[model samples]
Target: MSVDDGILEHMFESDFASADDKTVVAAIEECARAEAMLAARRLAATAELTARYTEPDEDRDHLAVDGWRMASAEISAAMRVGDRAASSQMCIAMALRERLPKVAALFAQGRLSAALVSTITWRTQLIVDSQIAQRIDTAIAQRAGEWGGLSVARLESAIDSLVDQHDPDARRRMREAAQNRDVRLGKRDDVTGTMSLWGRLSIADGELLKRRLAQLSSQVCKDDPRTAGQRRSEALGAIAANAEGLSCRCGSPDCPSAGQDDPRAAHFVINVITEANAPNTEPVPATPAESATAERAAGPVEPATEPQAAEPATERSKPRSAAALIIGGGLIPTPLLAELIKNGAKVQWVHKPPAAPETGYRPSGKTARFVRMRDMTCRFPGCTRPAEFCDLDHTTPSPAGATHPSNLKCLCRIHHLLKTFGGWGDQQHPDGTVLWTAPSGRTYFTHPGSRLFYPGWDTTTATLLVPTGPARHGDKGAMMPRRRRTRAQDRLRRIERERALNAIDRKRWAAPATTQPSRPPPQNDDPWKITTDANIDTTDTDPAPF
Candidate 1:
């Protein structure tokens, strides 16, 4: 049993059954698989060992500045591939929770590195409490650099002002300042001067004060664009009248009915006297000087009413032109509109007759909406203002052309009027260029150079060659019409070009199969080179005998 078993095992394990045969190939393949597995296991073990050796220590937070710098860079690098926003927040939190205290204490103890301290301070501020947040915000603002820089000193000054202004104790000073004010004078439609009340405030606090003033003014006074001093005086007067026991007697504040018997309406009489004494108040009508004085004493005042004008009888009978009737109702198409714009034409839509059915002449609202959506701006080559305020023009006369996209272009009011009513005419070229004719009959052409034409682009596909003469409207402008080509001819030409390209491609594909792959052309050598195929000796045997 031992001799027979040993022979069988040796035969199976042998590399070759005979020198000419490869029965041992199976054994060689099995050995190769085992070797590959062993190599992979060795690589895994080496990586594990490297990671174990380089793991950071627990007490590394207390390490020197160089250690912290390395740690921060490592942290940043690890986070580089994570979600950016989340990583930023995590970095701030990490700096605040981990590095901030260490850096702060180190700085306090004079043990921190400048670079580490600065970086930690910035990161820490990102997650600090609101009070410290405000301090940081003020610091940024105070630096007063281009946009977001704030110096420490400037920040402190701003904070102090904010604190002082909001303090209740400062109210008395504000009141005192208010009391020392004088009314600012302003012009009015009436003889009497008006008042304007408002005050200048600092930039940072101006918005806050203006907001408060608006609320307060809404409750107590009118915000006339008049002088602020006048508004303030009026405000003070109102306050005084409301004060205990010094009220006057009139129905309205500025009433001329002074010394009336209305105890409940005191502010009215006071305003009347005040308005009367006002130097800019209107003069009473002319009369004997003695009686005028008596009338003034009795309280002279004009009735408050809006001015009115008397209409003449002929105005009602005036007739509007027919063009006004059509445009007023917006009865026009859009495509015809764009074409008109390209041709530098405009319309004067006239109503055929008002007695005609409204259904026959009414326009679609899509006219305006489509114009806005398609030609969003003025279509006059370089004019880019929005088309909302533009005139929707028709290139061909209405009843002659439909409002298709090809017919419309938006022109601003001035250009619209100039092209329409103003004597200039335009012509569209076959190449998509535009030729314009001035009132003087001189022509100017716009040559569109290298402009690519896609479907729906009304301009020409070819580069436009501007002509040298008058480009009139209609038949006169039809110079150099584009030539039409047949599809068969175009197809033939394309096939010929493709044949030339296919010959080159066949040569390129066969090159490597027939010869060694080409090396790159040497630097400083001519790229356009001619090469000949090498001839190999094949006299003894054929390569493809099978």
Candidate 2:
């Protein structure tokens, strides 16, 4: 039955609870088939849109980078997505249309989902030979409908094996992942004053660090209140501070490491912005019994003279207010701020930001710092690359525009290229606001990310009276920077090299065994006797003597 006929029969059946189990199952199956068909239609439409923007003659040559980038920008604006995502859609669309006709047919018949089609296209990207690609496409399409129950890894392995048998050289090369090792700090979590730490390191270095942490974590006294995990966490902090070892919290005078300073400990600075005139409460003095109990439960405490006053019930019941802000970290609660201060955290007040923009092709260091602090991330809509890693692009090209804070905005490399070459236009306002115009003539506005965190800071700069001349058009003859070797050439060379190596290895494995020369028998018929007569005939079929 047709997918539309099935849908028409059950489209009004909203009361699934009253339906029989088989009927409900049938409805679900029909809906899934309908969804797949819809996804296929969407991909076809995307492919059509891409073709509309692409120059027909340039389609054969993938070097038409600007044409595809323009299409990506239009798709991005219309779909409310990033350029990378839009480009991915276009690539999948084109792959299905031009290279995987059999798979595309299955997708159109509602036997495959968009996600499955996407995977099929990506895994087959290395196949440059049209005949080989078509054969693989046909093979995959015949069995792809049964892959819905397979895990992603298993599915990839299945596809890879098929590709390998037909064209081993067409398999995607695994990159050197170790070369990309890096450490990164995740954004602040929902809990205040906390963030996640994750990274990749060489196996040897990771093991060494683990061993060091384990050694330091075990150095504390048995009476230490913290658990092994807590001790390891503290050890990491100790390492960061250049301390020799973690401090013992046993608080006993007889503890071997008591009353000693870590000479290796180095001073570290932390920037904190706090509200002026915050309430200050003196530490309450503890009795002798209370001190002992507190020491056993936590750690040692210093004696103080003043006692803290009790707050009213209403005030105590209210939620704790944020009293300070860490420079890169999130909000700090009042109690945590007090604890930080008690732990000898230094406090410094920052002066107001500069009011005027600087003059030059490059912004002054102070102005650059101010812009980074104000934006906090790239000003391109939907882009979240941190401001520190982005290029400070002029809203108006240099020479025509000044190096003012109002004109300078952060843009990552790809978006910067888009604005420079993909016919995108943008304007900046004095209040750190950016207005972007996509190639499709759609407009999007983005405000400073800092406004969400620091609403009180004044990011406004003086507006310049620079003249924006007639819109500059891209040179018709200009092309994207060419690679040393085109993709097709590179693929051909790599495949040939790999195939040559494989042939050598196969020849080595498949070589025929050579017959050994006949040995002379012992003259005296002694099995262990050695004989050196090369002319003696010992070619009998009998087994050799022991």
Candidate 3:
């Protein structure tokens, strides 16, 4: 039987005063289901429409852009949505149609919501093997309703777990993808002179940056009113200025303030997780540029011929510089890494597994730095406010909650208050992800920003490795003050240069030893020569005869 419109009207108007607790709760859940049903219908229509459009307008016009791109452009123009968003939606729709028939059926029936199915569709594609993908599809379809309440992090983790369990090569695939990390620095804008930064980083390199930034961010002056982000911005500028003052103009990582006035600034650390095991015959080039050039110059790098495969695994830790590329996520450029090594960067191998649990109400300065470095930013859903500006919230609540790194999280002031007073609830996992529950019971999750891309990162080596390099480019071994050139020496050099130039000028103007070529005597008699009166030498008796 169809419920009367008057019932919903009454539910909204009465605020559930006339209804029991069960009735109100049931009504809310049913409403959510209805909305999800509507979304499912819309996505189904979208899939059908996209399927028909094998060639979009741009394709017919000889623009090789994807068909969905043209559709996204039109959608953006008509609906005021971003083109990127539109294209993504179109892609999801097509993927669901082709790869996820069970999910598509569930969505059509409104048993599974479009949003939740989209999350499943997107993540399941990570399983490269079709058999593994089918297994995951079956697993998710079996628990469709249960998966709906899961937060995004939980859902992704669940999918990743299944893939790893089913696919033997999952770890290899992840490491291969991680190797493709890169950093991009955008051009400064004309109006603001501000550029954007975005990149993929290996966990080790990214953690180092966070630790450095946190240490620098803490160097605030009294009466400073700048925001946390502003402080970090200034700290970045200070890094450059500090290096400049050390006269370390060589843009090299090894020389990054190699010989510096400040010992503290010269010290840094990095963790060497693993090293390349090349045979004793040919060593690998240290930098990417050198590797490329060597490949070209040497006509492709030859593999190590003699295998020391007989060598024990224990010998790998001895470390004879096969390049640090494996550990830094390929994000740090070859030049920078070479410079760091050049300046005596302190290299430490990661041997520890994980940090011991701590139990304090308030975190120590050291703990706070580590937590900030680990988290990198606020741990609220979709909130990217830097952890520097955030409060360290106890995920389980303080006093009753232990002061462990696993228990603590960075929450911006606004979110901290919302969790403290607002109807939101959260639970932190051992892996540092937070499962957040809204007042209405919708679940979401936030994870430590730095560690997201690298799931298999060595937790023991998560702590930063500081490279105690030289203070300046030339400052190797001991720190020594360079002697200044005296004014007398400068003057003497200038005098010598002046004398050398004067001697050259005098020699250039001196007369030749050989006699100058003699002019033909009286060529005017030869009509063929056509000598003019002016051409006749005036020096020769005034050319009177001519």
Highest lDDT against the true fold, candidate: 2
User: TM-score order of candidates, best first?
Assistant: 2, 3, 1
Q: What is the C-alpha RMSD of each candidate to the true structure, in Å?
A: 40.8, 11.0, 30.2
Write one digit per residue (lDDT tens) for candidate 3, span 57-173.
Answer: 432323222234334433333333444565567767766776677777777677887778877776654344566666766777777778777888887777666655665333122
Q: What is the lDDT of residue 433 in candidate 1?
A: 45
Give the Å error, residue 213, model 1: 13
Residue 271's lDDT in candidate 1 = 10
Please report, as a residue range, the 10-residue window in candidate 3 with the lowest summed lDDT.
304-313
TM-score-wise, the better of 1 and 3 is 3
Candidate 1, residue 92: the lDDT equals 38
Against the correct fold, how does model 3 do in TM-score? Answer: 0.34
Q: Per-residue lDDT tens digits of candidate 2, residues 51-132?
A: 8876544433344345666677777666667777888988899889888989999999999887888888888777778999
Candidate 3 local lDDT, residue 205: 89
Give the lDDT of residue 91 in candidate 2.
Answer: 82
* Structural similarity to truth (TM-score) of each candidate: 0.19, 0.63, 0.34
